[model samples]
Target chain A: MSDRATLSTVAARAGVSPSTASLAFAGSPRVAPATVERVLRAAGELGYAGPDPIAASLRRGRSGVVGAVIGERLLYAFRDPVAVQMLDGLTEVLGELGVGLLLLAGDGGPAPAQLGRLPLDAAVFATCGLEDDPAFRLLRARRVPLVAVEGPVVAGVPLVDIEDRQGTVELAAHLRELGHRRVAMVTMPLRLDGRRGPVDADRLATGVYRDTRERLLGAREVFADLPAVETASNGIEEGEQAGAALLSGPDRPTAILAQSDLLAAGVLRAAAARGLAVPGDLSVAGFDGADLPWLAPVRLTTVVQPTAEKGRAAGRAVVALLAGEVPPDVVFPVVLRPGTTTGPAPA
Target chain B: MSDRATLSTVAARAGVSPSTASLAFAGSPRVAPATVERVLRAAGELGYAGPDPIAASLRRGRSGVVGAVIGERLLYAFRDPVAVQMLDGLTEVLGELGVGLLLLAGDGGPAPAQLGRLPLDAAVFATCGLEDDPAFRLLRARRVPLVAVEGPVVAGVPLVDIEDRQGTVELAAHLRELGHRRVAMVTMPLRLDGRRGPVDADRLATGVYRDTRERLLGAREVFADLPAVETASNGIEEGEQAGAALLSGPDRPTAILAQSDLLAAGVLRAAAARGLAVPGDLSVAGFDGADLPWLAPVRLTTVVQPTAEKGRAAGRAVVALLAGEVPPDVVFPVVLRPGTTTGPAPA
Candidate 1:
């Protein structure tokens, strides 16, 4: 190739053995730092992209890949503060352990079509709303050790979950105690099969995602007969749309319980658009108590789950599994964090 | 070690040659798919993480590491939407090609202490933030093929840049067209040295980062005397803080131009806090045109840069450089998009 040089040529130019050049490329701590530096300088002068890993991988039959199986391709899944925070926490743990994350997004993470052929040492299941995703089924087929985060309680797969149901119950009770009788809820997807319209009684039973199912039940357990709507994804816009649709009619709810902070935010925006006051005219609560500091003085009354703890638990489980120890599935507790978005029911 | 099984051992247990087992792992198009299925079924029974990549890396002299050098901690860098989107796009492209990414985030990439010790074939310079990052100096000394993204414009290192200056200028002109002369600005960090606060006439002379300097000049060219408040990072909260401070004092500009969409979101929040109706009371604009469907109805009047194109260009550059070609520096174009956030100056 015109201006480019291969590792062999770089080594030849540096007057070192090809093995030495290889050592330089690996950044092997064992190599004398000076010699590695010299090889790199020579390689740079020769216009090489260090070593071609594709060629090496063909021979070695291994690629340092850790797949992150995400359920959908919605843009918010990546930018949602809560999702990003959880990912950051997980990445912190995995990166320290010398692992890199391959975000295998949409349709069971990086193409369910290549169930067995994908190069991954292990796979972690990451999804936003609690929905029936095929991440478990596909990774299972590949024999990849599975670590599910905030999803169904799948057998044989280790899990990292939060106390989502209990947290919602506490939030609903809190809203009721604040003088709210006519309450409503904005729930996550009720079942798989990618349903996005109005949720019904039968769909609730067939809910595939554990968290969404539990949270909805928790809300019902609190208010007995609370009005509620379901959104396609956990997003502010979806929440706002749901809020608008629910609140548009004459017999509207006084308080709204959203499964996620983004949904709650949308509800707040909807209320604002309709000239309703947050606490004076309406009350709203959210889950995944993330810091929406930009929401300013209007804080969100919600549940705070330990995201980093979830990541650490997953990491510990991976380490244990690798060490041949059966790691028990972990369920981290959630705390009721009341903020300013909620108050007395509408007068 | 422990439960980790190498491909050779799996091959032995399956009573097949290591190469055959490797072929099974590859699932090559030429290989009989049935043979591939059987080899996998056997490998599954042996309790293997497929192949011990750490061991294979040592033996093969190449690690499938396309190390991306980020200027801050992984958490901080990963939080930014722009960085995350670029990473998402880059990974999407590389994943299809079986190239794994190692997000090596720290001042410039990895520290000098880590430069010679990472298993990277070629390193991509990610968000190094236009300073004399020690990481780049070390990568230079070590001769790692540096591919800078929206960073320093080193002579030899291949750069992947978006039209930041042009984009901002177009945005500023749109504001100008709307009859807004007293426009305020919020910018990304002016220097990699962390000397953040305000970039006045004096600081502009000693500006360090090429991208920052270019973007500032591009905006300045439109409104040369316009004063811009410098933010510590390109985040929403920071933008909100900047907006609150700027909008509070004397003669807050009718239009505020933010360098990033996240920051623009913050500014919108700040405006909301003050009961300022967007477009009705204040005209606002931003860059990077991030997906803001969540901030819907009030679509952002911003510039849209080709994010996926930039990532694809970087991927293609790496491929070409690997194939021994002089990959040219790529600077993608931008388009000015008008939305609900901007309107004619209030009467």
Candidate 2:
């Protein structure tokens, strides 16, 4: 253990005034890089951890709080690998700029119970897909500059989104190319709330789920008449429900396209339970490039979204917005991964 | 669009002083419960988004920076579902206190680049089973109150650990009960750092991975002479490496126990490639109650840790330390879940 050192010790060691050293670490451009390095080295030697974030935030009139809105509660959010990856990207970017992440758990509902009431400088959340995503409502009510991800685009709000429609379009096209005609789609919710059951014509007509709508639209672009069964949540159980309903009915589709990897896995489960041979008897696909190792020997043919990149973009959007610049809407490209799941339509 | 309302307006409407309204909304002890509700209603009507977090943090003299040292970069951390679950737990608890998470990336070297450089008030990391993680070194140097998960208890730092040994003991006992004599163990890094090859008596004596060490110790309590092959990392590739090493070896064990579910999945992949039958030729078990919907029909028999709870405990520990209280160590229990992967050892 070392004795706690202060900023003055670092300044003295660096042969610079305390103010100069302070400016360097404070991300001031006026300070020369060489000077900054010198101060940093000195601080490192003295074990000085730099300026207090609380004090600095007060001086800047900013909270330095970067709230990340998960579409669901802690249990659900943690279960989704894609969401975690996105958060990882966001956290990495925010770390560089001395910002902190506030994970606002917005399970099934719009937001966490206390999210809107918490102090936050900016937020990255989903408004369209969530039931009551408090991030948007709270930030919107507070007039806080926000950057949404895979969610609704409120007028004047910037976003870090992906080509959800294009990704699914590519997925659907690939499935179609594999000689698939009858295909069932498992979708995320179709609205801001968690009213999960069936996706009627009315839900599609008045689509509200941002991620779901985009992907559904993309699938429809390729499979114009494909029937989509809605899932309550992104979990596998919900996916299995949609799968059972679709597979159990008469004149079952030859293929199934799940909105998420979890749902795709569930569809596989449903197919297996129904005694359907995978790829040979039924083909299943999913979105989101998650590592489903337990599904070993079986690769899912799906569209892979760069979740971390999306998060980084969101973080960048927050930084830019904080810096008084409106970030252009960012839509990352998704790659269509051809795996073992989708094969030529059964004879 | 709604106007950004302030506490002053809520106070004015509630016919109270600004301080009273602020206290009410802040949920301070000074304010009566009824008065807090009154203020909350007024603020809700006015669309006020509670007190400014930045301002509150400033007044508290802490940035709420709880340095979370993950094993690798941001992307890598997100890739691990278990890690994400734990983090999600931590975030939920911290959110309640308005605390922010500062992610610290670790390369598990003598001098961790990100951890040493980042300005953090306190840190939570694990014993990487390496010589000593650079993140821990820097955090120690800075005298930050520390909380470790899945690592050994360092002096002055509270350990948020699990019953890795107990769970592994139970797992081995279960295998024995199921009629297994020759059993093998596939494990995460035996050393805190890199590829340490196999976990024989010599290497096991100097193993760096705390969880691996403990679990192996517990398994040995039952098996006594279970041959162990160590993986380079927690991913499927590493698991495959160990799996290949195990299967290719002359004395093939009837059953195998993998340290992680992902690694166990890799073993299953290797088995499939080798034309081996699961639960017939070789029954396998793993740790961590992870979601593997893609595995479809095959579930893993493994030890499940309360990842979210571990994270929540870490978050609570940080909050407690930040508030000048020395919290006790939290040891979460791990359960042995018998999935389809593990069955009767052999005929």
Candidate 3:
């Protein structure tokens, strides 16, 4: 490592000033092409590589890396199409900005102790309900610009959120319009700890996950006595379990509203297992209009939130925060996409 | 910014040595409790946060970040279950090691110019056939430790590769044993450029992507005159298009072997579009035993690679390389999972 050559050595070998050498390596037009060639030749002779990133970052006061704090484990998070699409959009913006994405997995609060040493210009809390996250506290202590995608919004940190409540309300109303009086719900985790099973009234009213709480509230407005089962995670298997619990009973609901498309897919699977025809025996509606191409022939009736756009919005907020400008909190709209899965309630 | 408190200032205010002040911040047990408390009070008074990450990195000579270069867009890459599963595995290891994952999207060759300024201690060429990748050259020039997940296995860089040829040969044999005389292949991209259309003999012999080429060769060993269609991307839609192109022709084969399960799903969709029954009209086989829950009841007959294990092996190699130890290249085995998609050809 000591044998490694520096820009100064290259400059000295080229008989050029250090600044000129730097300019040549940076591809600056100020340096003459012939002089650049000479510097390159010297660099080749001395086995000097390009400018070191550490030195460059020190000079610029920027790490050229943005940390994306994912709340859940990578295995579970990557399984969700909504999360994947959002991440894809965020990567698009960050990639175009020339900054690499540094994934930081957080469990609700502040990052792990290991992240204490990482140099991040800004951090995006991609998961929801992070107000109590210890990682968040640590990042705040580091004075890095922070952006939240959903909830527990922190002061001074700009937020990019979706209208989660409105989407559920519309879907529930659509079901009500079809004369579905008995409806059961499958919900996202009430908190980051992944508590599952029958959700009581008190838990529903005081849940930590803002998106889940808000969506549940919206659904309650339509069906005042709608019972819900919270899942351990937003996955098809969990959805299936929740669906089985709800549909196996003697008094089954005519319609089921799931928080995500993947969960709705699970519900569909449970229905199939019981030999129940969709929209005939049960009507299932899901949120997050994810393109489940494999779930063919049965397009889900869902509220289409702009998943990618939400991510891009978060990316924009990050850019703004980095530029020393405060970005306003954003709340994207959601639309109801009627598909073959939902229809008039069975007489 | 200029008035921000330093460790020296806190030390001076606390009337303690700077070394003690540093130890207090680092939570070192060497410092007396009273001295640590004094240093903390001084730090609080001065409004000093923890030590700066950039400064710490410069002192330690490690960025605490590892770059994983994916040679494709995140959107397209995330669509493939195999890629997602592998990434999930890699992240699990890196997380335990206390290093943040820096996602670097590469376009087959060099990284974008912006990436040159990003600080990375080591780089993983996680994508395939990156011998000529510009980013690879840059990382090598920077003296960063390198790990490859697959081919173009560099001389010193330890590689983690799967037995790409064996699985395909086994699957093709299974198809042949079913008395299938005619077979059509839907292959992954022969190159990163995603050229889709009829695949000829010369193109097959001189393909750039090693995995695609090896799989093609494996299939050819059984069906010497096997015709194929190459897809532009490793996506269900691309597979669907390729499938439609092959299955819609006048002289359709008795069986179609897709290079990936996602593509096989597309072939299934195409079959559904044409009202063809599986194993009755056409027997389909696929590679990469991914869990396609949405493709329910029609379990795919495919080759199952240990995707997660492959990623973990690469991660281990990275750990070894960073520790100044040379690790041997690893080749993981594949298994043939016979599912409902393939059976005896129609009589």
What is candidate 1's lDDT per residue for A5-79, written digit by digit as tens? Answer: 778899998889999999888878988888988898898788775655445544454344566666665244665
Q: Give the alpha carbon lDDT tens digit for every residue of B200-299 in model 2.
A: 7878777766887888889899998888888767877778778888898898888889988878888888887788899899898888887665565688
Ranking of candidates on lDDT, top first: 3, 2, 1
lDDT against the true structure, each candidate: 0.73, 0.76, 0.84
C-alpha displacement of B168 in model 1, angstroms? 2.9
Summarize candidate 3's per-residue lDDT along A1-347 as a digit string, tens digits: 46678899999999998899999999999999999999999999888877878877767888889998888877677778888788788887877788888887653112477777788999898865555777888788878899988866878988899888888899999999999999999998987666888889887766778888878888988999899999998889989989999999878999999999989999999998988899899999999999888787789999999999988998888889889999999999999999998888999
DockQ, per-model, please? 0.22, 0.34, 0.49
C-alpha lDDT (0 to 100) for residue B225 of candidate 1: 80
Which candidate number would show the highest lDDT if scored against the true structure? 3
What value does the lDDT take at residue B108 in candidate 2? 18
Docking class of 2: acceptable
lDDT of 3: 0.84
Estimate the TM-score of every prediction: 0.80, 0.81, 0.95
The residue-level lDDT of candidate 3 at B318 comes to: 80
Candidate 3 to truth, TM: 0.95
- What's the lDDT of the predicted structure labeled candidate 1? 0.73
